[model samples]
Target: MVALYGALFLSAFLAATILPVSSEVVLAGLIVAGRGDPGLLLMVATVGNTLGSVVNWVLGRGIDSLRNRRWFPVTPDRYEQASRIFRRFGEWTLLFAWLPVVGDAFTIAAGAARVNLGVFVALVAIGKAARYAVIVAGGLWAMA
Candidate 1:
């Protein structure tokens, strides 16, 4: 059980970063196999994901060369959109910051823009926790 959760934590945490991977599939498999505890699973998933996001935040803050990539040229439209989001949402973006593709980018942008790392982490944790909680709860409910 511990091994399963650790694998889940690492897998989910890593997947949430800029790297392309997903733990939800593995989570579903575990739920299907009836392995481990549901509550603990959620906790592990959330913690792992939050930690990964923090790493991404650190990277984003330090790496000032993303714009050099072909995929990431400095465009006024993007900057304007990010600016508006930052201006209006401020720290609230962290709540929805777990939503699929957008979530990863949101966190990175928060770091690149030098947004308060603490607030960014807090909000992301809130969202990440809720996401895993919902998934685990749903899986348990369905199994029941």
Candidate 2:
């Protein structure tokens, strides 16, 4: 059970970075296995996921001055778009951050765009927490 939680932590963290991975899928499996209480599992997964996102934000924050350097995968233009979306949507984007492919990119983009660290972390936490809650609820409902 703890291993599954740790996997979610590692997977979510790495996935938030440039690497391609799906912690959510693993979460689903763990839920099905009844490894942990659904609520607790969701909370752990969400926190792990959000922490991973912060890494990307920190990366972007570091690059605040130079924009996207040639070596980096992100570009200034993409960063601008992220900043605009974040400004318009504010914390809302975190809700959608759990989305399949887009979720990971959104996290990285948040950093590249240099969204506020505190707000960014909070939003990601909310978004991921919501996602896990929904998943657990649905899983329980289905089992019922």
Candidate 3:
């Protein structure tokens, strides 16, 4: 059970990062395997994913310092565009942080724009939790 939880957590975290991992597959596999309580799985996955987004948020906060560094891949125009989109959409875009490709960008943009940390976390948790809940429900249903 501990191993299963750890795997789920790791998968969730990686999925939330720039890496193209799919935590949903790990989650559904666990459900199919009947490894742990569904609620626990949901909680673990959500928290791990949310924390991963926070990493991007922190990176965004430091984007200015990192911009000129060769290690930083985002171009000036690209970063500016992301910041602009966040500015236009506002904090609500954090709810879509669970999405792929673009989701990580939104979280990073929120950080670069210096969004209220409290609101950023709240919205991100809500969105990520909701996504895990849906995945759990769908997995259980499909099993039945």
Instruction: Give the count of colliding residue pairs in each prediction.
Output: 0, 0, 0
Over 4 Å off, model 3:
67-81
Q: Give Cα-based local distance difference scores for all models.
A: 0.73, 0.70, 0.85
Q: What is the RMSD of candidate 3? A: 2.0
- Top TM-score model: 3
Per-residue CA lDDT of model 3 for 31-114, tens digit only, reads 877889999999999999999888888988998786677645355666676667778889988898887656777888888888
Off-target runs (Cα >4 Å) in candidate 2 are 64-80, 100-115
Per-model TM-score on C-alpha atoms: 0.83, 0.76, 0.89
The weakest ten consecutive residues by lDDT in model 1 span 70-79
Model 2 lDDT tens row, 76-136: 5655665576668765776677666455556666776667778777778887787778878
User: If both were scored by TM-score, which would come out higher, candidate 1 or candidate 3?
Assistant: 3
For candidate 2, what is the TM-score?
A: 0.76
As a whole number from 0 to 100, the lDDT of residue 97 in candidate 2 is 70
Tens-place lDDT per residue, model 1, 104-142, is 666666777787878887899899888777777778777
- Against the true structure, candidate 2 has what lDDT? 0.70
